[model samples]
Target: MSDVNQASQTLLDSNPASQRIPPSVFLLTGAVAVIGSNSLVLSPIAPEVAQSLGVSVPMVMSGTAAFGLGTAASALFLARHIDRIGAWRMLRIAFMLLTASLLVSAAAPVAFVLVAAQLGAGVAAGVALPAIYASAAAIAPPGRESKTVGIVLTGWTLSLVAGVSISAVLADWLDWRAVYGAVFLLAAGAFAVLVFNGHRDKVSTEPAALPLAALTIVGVRPLLLACGAFMTAFYGVYAYLGDHLHSVLGLPISANGLVTLVYGLGFGAAAFLDSLEKRVSPRLGLPAAFLAVALVYLLMAMENGTYGAILALAFLWGLANHLGLNLLIVRLTALEPGRRGAIMGLNSAVTYLAVFAGPLGFGWLYTTAGFGALAGLAVVLMVVAILAAYAAPSTPRN
Candidate 1:
C-alpha cells in the first residue's frame, strides 16, 4: 500500500467503530469551543482588565499580541513533535496547558502576569491546532477532509459570536475576572471530554517522520504566501472591528458585540456552504468566496454609519474569510499528504504572523489613510488572493 493508504488504514484500525465516537464529531466540536472561547471571551474584557491591573489599555492588549507571537514561535517545532508524541497526547497536553493558563490569567494580579498566561495559552494553541487538523485529515474518510476541517473550524465562528455575546453580558454583570473564570471552567470541561475519549484508544507507536527536504520541495511556497496574505487581511479587520465600530460609528460596546455576533453568524453559515465543494469544485467555490469578500470590503468602505449596511458587510466578510481558510487547508493537505503536519505548521506560522502584524499594520493605515483607504487595501489583497486561487493547481479526485 502507498503511504497515504497506510496512514489512512492505521487511523481507521486504531479506532474501531464499536470502541470510538467518530473522531470528526468529537474533535471538531471540542476544538471549536475550546479555541474560540479563548479570544471571544477575553477581547471584551481588555479594558476592564487594564483598569483592574492599573495599567493602560494598550498594555492590557499586549496579551493578545503575546498570544499570537507565542503561537508563531512554537508552530514549527511543535509540528516536528506531533507524530512522535502521538497527536492525541499532544492535544491532551495542549488542553491541560490551556486550562492552566486560563486559570493563571484569571488569577493574575499584574498585567505582565496576564500577558505571560496568555502567551502560554498561545503556545498550547500552536500545538493543539496543527495536531487537530492533522488528526482530522488522518481519521476522516477520503473526500470528507474539507468538511471535517470546516466543522472543527466552525468552533471559531461560534466562539466569536457566542463567546462575545455571552462575555459581554458577563462583563456587564460581573467583573472581567469573572469572565476569564468562566472561560477557565469551559476549558476544564473540554479538557475532560478529550481526555475521557482519548483514553479509550491505544496510542500509535509508529515513527511518523517526514523528510524536511520533501516539505521544502512540495509546491508550498505560493500556498504559504497566500495563507499569510489572506490572514493578514482577515485578522487586520477582525482585530480592530470592535474599536472601529465604537470610534467610527459612535456605537456602544454592546452594539459592537452585536456586530461581531453577526460576523460570527456569517462564519458559521460558511461551514454549511463549505460542503458545497462536493457540488461545486473548490477551484470555482474558493474564488467565488474571495470575490464575495472583496465586495464586502467595498461595502464596508462605502458605509457611513448605516447599521444594516455594516451588519451585512460584516456577515459576508466572516463567511468569505472562513471559506477561503478551509479551502487553503484542503489545498495544502492535498498537495502533500505525508507532510500534512509540516505544511500545516508552516501554514499556522504564516497565519499567526499575519495575525500578529495585521493589527499594528492596520492601526497605522487607519491613522494615515482612514477606513476607506484601509478598505481599499483589503480589496486589493483579496483580489490578489483571487488571482492566486485561480493560479493554484486543481486537486485530482480520488
Candidate 2:
C-alpha cells in the first residue's frame, strides 16, 4: 500500500465510523473564502475604488483580469511542485502567500498596488485549488469523493453570497476598505487553524515528474472542451449580473445583493445534492442542468418578466453552473489517478483562461448588441457544453 493508503488506514482503524474531515477541507475553504470574498465585494466597490484611485471602472475591473492571468500563469508550475514536495506542505506555503497578499491588498493605497496584490492572491489560489482537489480524492472513501469535494467547495459559493451581501451592506454603512479588512481577519483566523492542527500527511513512493505527454493526449480532450465552454458561459453570466440587473431591470444598487443571494442559494442547494453522485451519474445530471439554464436565459432575453421570474432564472443559472463545475472537477480528477494533481492544475489553468475571456467578451457584446445578443450567445455555449458531456467517456469510481 502507498503512504496515503497507510495513513488513511491508520485513521480508519482509529475511528471506525466517524467521518473525518480531511485537512484539504480547511485549507481549500480558507483559500476560497478569500477569493470569493474579493470577487464579490470588489465588483460593487469598483466605482468607489476608481474614484478613490483616480481611475476608470474598466481599470478597476482590469484588476480582476490580472488576477485570473496570475492564476493561469502559476498553475502548471505549482502542479509540478506539488507532485514533488507533497500537497499538504505546498498548501501551507500557499496559505502563507495568500495571507500576505490579503494584507497587502487591504493596505494598498493605489490602484497599481491593489492590482499587484490581487495578482499574488490569484497565484496563491491557483496553487492551492488543485492540491486541495487531489488531497480530497486521495482521502475520500470510494464512491464519495465527488460529494466530499462538493462540500469543501460549497464554502466558496457561500463566500460569494455572504461576501457580496454583507459587503454591500458594509459598504453602504462604512467604506469598501472595511470589506477587505474583514476578510483579512478571516484569513488570520484560518492561518491560526492551520498552525494549531497541522496539515494531514499523505504517503506515495512514485517518482515525481511533469506529465507533458499526458497533456498532449486526446483522452482529456472532451473534458477540456467541456470545462472551457462551461466556464466561459458561467463566468460571463456571473461577472456581469450586477450590471445586467441594474441596466436592464432599472433596479437599484442594493438589488445586486438580493439577486446574488438568490443565485447563491441555488448553488448551495445543488451542492447539497451533489453528494448523491454515487447513485446518479454526472453524465445524466450535467446535461439536464445546462439545458435548464439555457431555457432560463432564453426566457430572460425574451421578456421583461416580473421580479419573481427574474430571481427564479438567476437562481437556476447559479444552480446549473455549480452542478456542472463540481461534476467536472470530480470527473477530471478521476480521469488519471496517478496524475491527479497535474490534471486538476491544467483544469484550473483552462478554467481561469475562460474566466479571463468571459467577462471581456460578454461586456463587449453587452455594450454593442444588447442583452438579447448576450443571452443568445449563452444559449449556444450551453448547447456545446451539453454535447461535450454526451461525447465524454464515462469513468467508474473505485
Candidate 3:
C-alpha cells in the first residue's frame, strides 16, 4: 500500500497541471501574456511606429501580415519539433529568439527592419505557444485539463487589453519602441525563471516525421479544419471590430475601447466551460459551441442599430470562441497524446493562415455588401465548422 501511494504521487507529479496553479504554470501563462501582448503591440501603435520609422501607417500596418506569415511558416516546419526538443527547453530557446527580435525592433533603422523583427517575433510565438499550451494541458489534473488550458489561454484575451491600452499609454509617454523594450524585459525574466526551476521534462518517444504527416490522420484533420473555419469566422469581424463599430454600429471612438474590454472579459469566461466538458464529451461540446457562435455572428450581422444587441453578441462571441478554441486543442491532444506538439503546430498554422484571410475577406465584404453581409459570411463558415467539429473524435471524461 505504501508503495502504491508512492507510485500514485509520482504519477500525479508527472501529470500536466496536476498540482493546481503551480508557480511554473503561472509564470508560463505570464510569459505567454507578454508574448500575446507584443504580437498585437504594433497594431495599436502603428501610427507611432510609422512616424518613428519615417513611413506611412499603411506601410507599418503591413507588418501584421509579416507576423502572420512568419507564424504560419514556423508552425508548419519548426513547431513540429517540440516533442523532441521538450517544452521547457523549447520555451527557453523561444524566449531567446523573442528577446533578440524585440531588441532588434527597438533599434530598427527603418520600416524594413521593423517588419523583419516582427516576423521573427511571430516565429518565436508560433514555436513557443504550441509547446506552452500542450505542456500546460498535459500537466493538468486528470479531469481539469480543459480548465488548465483555459487558464493559460486567458493570456490571449488579456492581451487585447494589455497590448492595446498599455502600449498606447507607453507610446504617448515614450516612443513605441519603449513598448517592445519593456516586452523584452518581461520575456527575459520569464526565461530566467525557467532556467532556475530545475524541472526536467521527459522527451516524447514518437518518431520525428510523425508531426508532419499528422494532417492526413482521422483524429487530427477534421478538427484542424473546424478550427480553421471557426477562427476565420470569429476573427473576420473581430479584427475589424473597432472600425466596424465606429462605422457600422455608429459607436463613438471613445466607447469602442470599452466595448472590446467587455468582449475580452467574456472570452475569459470560457474557463468555466470545463464544467460543461466534464458533463459532456468535448466532441459534442465543441459542435454545440460552434452552433452557438453561428447564431451570435448571424445576429450581429442582421441587427446593426440596436446598441444592446451588438454588445450582447460581441460578448457572447468571445465566450463561445473561448470554448471552441480550448476544446479543439484539448481534443487534438487527446486524439494523439504522443503528437501533442505536432497537432498544436498544425492548429497554430491553420489559425495564423486563417487569421490573415479573415481580415482581408471580411474587410472586403464590409466594404462592398456592408456589415450584414460580412456577418452572413461568418455564419456560412460557421455552419461548415459545426459539421467539422461534429466529425472530430470524442473522448469521455475519466
Best by lDDT: 3
Better of 2 and 3 by TM-score: 2
| Comparison by lDDT, 1 against 2, better one | 1
Residue 173, candidate 3: Cα error in Å is 6.8
Task: For candidate 3, give the lDDT.
Answer: 0.75
For each candidate, what TM-score against the reference?
0.87, 0.88, 0.85
Off-target runs (Cα >4 Å) in candidate 1 are 1-24, 40-42, 50-58, 199-217
- Model 3 pairs whose backbones collide: 15-139, 16-138, 16-139, 16-140, 17-139, 17-140
Give the per-residue lDDT of model 1 (tens digit) for 45-151: 55556667898644666677778777777676676567666677888888899999999988998989998998898888888888778777766655567777777
Q: What TM-score quantifies how close candidate 1 is to the native fold? A: 0.87
What's the lDDT for residue 62 in model 1? 66
Top candidate (TM-score): 2
Enumerate clash totals for all models, in the order shown.
1, 2, 6
Q: State the lDDT of candidate 3 residue by residue for 13-68, as single tens digits.
A: 78775656655667667777878777666655665677688886546655665777
